[model samples]
Target: MRMLRYCSLLALVAALAACSSVPGGGPVSQTKGEYKVGNPYKVAGKVYVPKADPHYVAEGMASWYGPKFHGRKTANGETFNMNALTAAHTTLPMPSYVRVTNLENGRNLILKVNDRGPFVGDRLIDVSRRSAQLLGFEKQGVTRVRVEAVPGPNARPATVFARNTPAPATSPVEQKKAPIVVASARPAPVFTPEPAKKDEVVVQPLEAEPDSPATASENIYVQIGAFSDKLRAKMVADDIRHVGQTLLELVDINGQKLYRVRIGPLPSKARADETLGRALAWGHNTARIVLD
Candidate 1:
């Protein structure tokens, strides 16, 4: 009877403690985070400056983190929860919100940004595992996505749909939906005669016409962009050739032709990462690695 009473008393004390802290069981975080625009920092040879931009938007690959990152400290000072609808971005201010739309599946969701990451490749964002599932790309691991900032840090999720995605050719052009300002990472000077600055590197434009590429080769390539227009593809290839060996190729997708600008056949994944960082820092938002 003494042991039973002691157990009951412990339970009662725990309930009272919870009530005192939360007041009617209100929602709260164990480690609350805050809104912050962090300083410029370098990772893997890439420098990123975090700042508040209401017009931030870009198109790129989106990956997810769960088991490895769960219960960690987020950049915003909050405890990371893989089950929560949170994300990590390269340059966006912490504790901000964005609408992430999977370009392949048309899965759109408004998620909170609370950490800094995805320092891997040219990936644009690292979403929580739950966000991946809700966005309908958890099974595939990664998906092409268009992410745009939305106002109101307290914004709630709305209007989710994942099966209505468009074709690859049309999705790139769909980036014209407007109200987007690229991150602070401005494009590098490609054709400048002046010496490269201490903080900036000059990329060279492609001077010669690249032949049709071997897309099925076992080599690796960094896809700079895909365009429905051949001229735009060639222009992008010329514009960002200094990123690496540039290649411009056209291929038919379901009877539709897409001009793909890429930097290719890198010697190793480490070189690929450096190239990706350079591409991202140079403001190529859609850049990502792919097998040739």
Candidate 2:
């Protein structure tokens, strides 16, 4: 009986050691400074407010970071592992749970938002390399995606959108070719507006040309603005319309209404590039190209 008890204790010790060898194993201890609701901070001239509420949703471009950021201390005081399912956001509270869906493909993933970054433009989130791989966008550095925060206890369920279906296969003959350089017969007008002053809207009128006919083929758009107020979005759309045709879309994000202003169903990438350049010259620097 004594021998048997000694063997059992040895087996227990071996099992505990094995468990400790696993990643994220060993004695579970709260990370120092984790789960903090940070105060508003500024990055690249934009202010970001970090609050603790879990009901948040947004849609925009998502890019992934790997080697350069791997093993670094994240915003939540935890080490960032590129292989782990983690992400970064500009405003959401650190250590929050989010559901990210790739709009191009129907892939979806759940990630822990532990860092803060991708603060260049209008990008919504920056995911880890593994998250991007699982979402089927690893090859492409960036892709369009929708992100929704997972609610905590007693919070309402997030609004889910139907997944986009794959487009029908096209024959080789019908396949669209890559955009070629097309010299404009007339010099595209260069509209340079003064830098916007605080609390002031920059509006410079361009020569109003005839609106282009809507195309049935798949086209791209450059999204310029998203606002909770419909009137505000319309006003921005009107400003953009001074340059070219515009489209307004109402999107529901986390049970909140958002009005999005977009320009064009541009026929080709070259045209899209030209339009984007013109918009940037006009001081609409946040405009991003989107597929329609």
Candidate 3:
């Protein structure tokens, strides 16, 4: 009876050992899928405050990460997959959803923001390889995009203010049209070149005849830098001149004069996007598309 009891105890111990041994001897990490409002986290000396409710909208350059980071743990404890439609954002809550729109090609998709990253310059979000492919920016490595949060099911409705009462309607005769007045033409302004200081580059504006009514359309430019001093703006323009034809324009914003360095009056949005990607690669990370 003692021998039989010893054999039974040994068998029970073997069974317990078998149950505890995982396939590869590595413990599996539990993935947290619930929404979490994380505390303020600092990366590269910048503090990012995570928002509990999804109410964020921003536009900037985006980049993607691939095989090097595959299978690693994400910010929310989930396994990272390069093939998954997931992304990493700095300030949005973990395990949240966002709608990313590629401003260049107009291709848009929804992706889960499950990680944190892209601590590089001025990049708004870092998406997975699969997400980049879907957004049509995989080959270029970077593109300008607009990101907005998609509210979850339990999200509260946005507050709406009541509209003011409308004014009383008037009869057609009471709203008679006013007489049209003809305006006089003014003399064209003279163009004078500004004096340049030593070691300062001066970029002249391109001359063109007055545009006809049939050819009128808004021109778009990629603004790389704006500075209060023309010499500083010229220095930046000289540094980035190899990217494309660089131009300088004087702009007034909020009563402050600024010299803006721009890339082009790019013909189309697609071309502008391609140039934007190249600019980012050349270290002009904060370059952005502007409509004039």
Candidate 4:
């Protein structure tokens, strides 16, 4: 009888160890707890943790997904539609909804966080192709934006299958929420181009023709205008400076001493134009496009 009891105890211990040894294994109940999907997911080099009440409000660079993942399975097993007003988040529940705003242009977009990533630096979320376009990132390719969780019913299925089925389009009223209008129909503009003139054509005397047109990371810079109050300038700067890349500089443009905010080392004029457009959508009409 003593031997039988010892054997039973040993068997129980082995079973417990096996259960814990399973990858991403955790407590298992018939009705799982919040985010019972599995342990955190490891992809590329980053680990993504799912949260039940993962309400995140962050400011960072916003990018978009396109042909690369049009019909691929999202983190929640849903079919990713680049055109949908959906987004990818690292931790928010599979079907959680979010509101992304371009503080610079006052553009806002509501998106469903059914996927994961932007995983490049301090970026918080990656919006869908349509969402990014609506947020004015289609042309610029990337922009600084704010993301906030919005309350919603969690009844929506977490995954979508890309059959011939199509999701309903966002209504005009819904689109209005996005202050910046990006053209989704057009492909991303080509940034690289041949030099305009092979040899230096001096339009101005001794004006050192810029050594090769500015590359996207070298030439384009932004200048923010001043407000009647210093507080306002700081407020706008705080909103626009989502990425550490953007810097606030105090300078005079056209004899007006203003609190100038600038970003980049953008390489070319085309890139500068694209970035300027995004700044406009962010509501910085006075923001200047400069080459430095």
Ranking by TM-score: 1, 2, 3, 4
In model 2, residue pairs whose N, Cα or C atoms come closer than 3 Å (at least 3 residues apart or on different chains), thus clashing, are none
Query: What global local distance difference test value does model 4 have?
Result: 0.54
Q: Write the per-residue lDDT of candidate 2 for residues 1-292, one digit (tens) a residue.
A: 9999999999999999987663332122134426655889998889988776556778999999999988889987899878766799887776666778788865566667788988978999999996786566889889999887774211222222123423325632354423222121222124444443333332323222223433565457766755666677766676566445777766544444456677776766656655654454343534555554
lDDT of 4 by residue, 1-292 (tens): 9999999999999998987663343222111122234468877777877766546688888888888999887765677777556787777766666667765565665566777776787777888876675565688878877777765422222111111223226522233221211111222112222222222111111112134356444355654443434455566566555312455444333333344355555566545545544454344434455554
Worst-scoring 10-residue span by lDDT in model 3: 156-165
CA displacement after TM-score superposition, residue 44 of candidate 3 (Å): 1.4
Candidate 2 regions with alpha-carbon error over 4 angstroms: 1-33, 152-292
Model 3 segments more than 4 A misplaced: 1-31, 152-292
TM-score of each: 0.45, 0.43, 0.42, 0.40
TM-score winner between candidates 3 and 4 = 3
Error of 4 at 143 (Å): 1.2
Lowest lDDT 10-residue stretch of candidate 4: 200-209
| Residue pairs with backbone atoms closer than 3 Å in model 3 (clashes) | none
At residue 213, candidate 4 shows an lDDT of: 58
Which candidate number would show the highest lDDT if scored against the true structure? 1
The number of the candidate with the highest TM-score is 1
lDDT of 3: 0.64
lDDT, residue 7, candidate 4: 100
